[model samples]
Target: MLIVHVAVTVLLGIGAFFLLVGSIGLLRFPDFYTRLHATGKCDTLGGGLIILGAMIYHLFQYPETLLVSAKLAFLIFFVFIANPTATHAIMKAAYKTGVKPWRLGEERR
Candidate 1:
């Protein structure tokens, strides 16, 4: 039980770290496309991992409650669908707005 708790804590911590890194990248990265890439990939991964850790913790802590498990599964499913769709929408909007990608070796003017 203690081990499970520790593992869950560690996983959640890692997920939080990734989320923070993604946010910083979104602010610090040059160009819109690069920022979008960082936010989309890292944020989704962080959110997924965080949800997974929570689900694991809940399963271990409440084995008899199928309702909690089902709820967590549903949350994960929604996030998996929503995050990618949001990212796609952002990318599509950027493309339509003529937001250009940052070319390698090209200095920001």
Candidate 2:
């Protein structure tokens, strides 16, 4: 359906936009923790949106592919859970290893 196609297109575009912003943040942020925060948040959202778009498109375009949609849903769930957890773990490790947080008036790391 035309509506479905339009929705899919919009979702894909927005997802791509978030991904681009995340990558830019990764490159531009001064500190490692800030960069990780940007990427961890944005990547989870962007990837979920993209996968959701794909799932919706597949559902409407090919009703037979229900299993695929289910898998995509699982993938989205995994990303949502894994990304933040991994980010926290890495941040904790950095702190334990004496990686200091960026302070105001300090030179970029």
Ten-residue segment with the worst summed lDDT in candidate 2? 100-109
Inter-residue clash pairs, candidate 2: none
Q: What stretches of model 1 exceed 4 Å from their correct place?
A: 105-109
Best by lDDT: 2
Residue lDDT tens for model 1, 33-94: 88878898888879888988999998999899978988988888898889889989989998
For model 2, the stretches where C-alpha displacement exceeds 4 angstroms are: none
At residue 77, what lDDT does model 2 achieve?
95
- RMSD to native for every prediction? 1.8, 0.8
lDDT of candidate 2 over 72-103, digit per residue (tens)? 88999999999899999999999999998998
* Top-scoring candidate (TM-score): 2
- lDDT of model 2 at residue 10? 95
Error of 1 at 102 (Å): 2.4
Model 1, residue 25: C-alpha shift (Å): 0.8
